[model samples]
Target: MSSSSTFPRARKPKLGYDTDQVEEFLRVARRAFDGTPAPGDPEVSAEKIRLTAFGMQKGGYSTAHVDAALERLEDAFAARERQIAARLHGDEAWLREARTTAQVVSNRLARADGERFERVNPLVLGYSVKEVDRFAERLSRYFSDGWPIGIDDVRTVTFRAQRGGYRESQVDLVLDAVVDVMLAVR
Candidate 1:
């Protein structure tokens, strides 16, 4: 069970999330996570959580703080789901899926850095090409040599936004897939 205490209380001003609403939502989410259904519980899927919106209140929860907490919750749920899938399907099946997914990611990474992802207009901001490429190299190594990397490592990867860099969404989606593969195999 996640304690409400772990969530920072919102301020009194209207700039933050509504304190009561966020707390109540978290409580229900935590219950749902514990396998006890709560009334009006949102689907705890990673995409749903990532796209969740909270009502703002004068002194409500800090947006950044709540967002960070939600990200952690999404990761936990994803990891648990992967664990259940692996247990049900067996290691061989999970490994095969992981390898296949890794190969897809590796193939994308094999392209030249400038061509690896869809590019935005030169004036638009996107992920740094060099940074993403370097990380892609590490991912390639992981797939080829069975490197000691973890799902969290992939989940936490960040790149600087730059002009004419790879599409941020593309890289993020691939990283999400990588995390899924790592979790499934673990």
Candidate 2:
């Protein structure tokens, strides 16, 4: 498929995600989403879409557009997964699993700022403790106080890097779990 029909190009002198890579991935994702994935295809899942990264090239597909599309695709996959689970396990069981995940996430966020997630080495840079803590507070409130926090908010959040700050992978795992729970209940 032509990248132009799939997404707009970045303006000249600007760099965006590699067009060929994104186009091919999207085609594979479409097949996966339709449950017609071919043999030897890389397993495509909602988590895979969330973790996907593309190389950059000048005048390539717009990063923002590609990212937004990916988010929507991930949501579609998540919802499909949720439906399948519910059909297989019953709605109550599915809801129970979601509740358990939410509890675990809330407990993790319950820690004091700068202590919630593991920190990196003194010389290694990680997510800013202050920024992550602030976001954690919001997440905590969303769970404990029923504050409205969209999945997109967590999906798109960015934290500044700091020396000896919270570990990125750990934070990301929690965020992904939160998204899973949110998608489950939706």
Top of the candidates by TM-score: 2
Q: After superposition, how far is residue 67 of candidate 1 from its true place, in Å?
A: 6.4
Q: CA RMSD for every model?
A: 3.9, 1.2
Clash-forming residue pairs, model 1: 10-60, 10-61, 11-59, 12-58, 12-59, 13-58, 13-59, 14-57, 14-58
**In candidate 2, which residue ranges exceed 4 Å CA deviation?**
none
Q: lDDT score, residue 150, model 2? A: 93
By summed lDDT, the worst window of 10 consecutive residues in model 2 runs over 1-10
TM-score of every model?
0.72, 0.95
What lDDT, from 0 to 1, does candidate 2 have?
0.93
At residue 66, candidate 2 shows an lDDT of 97
Instruction: Write the residue-wise lDDT of candidate 2 on 119-144 in tens digits.
Output: 99989999999999999999999999
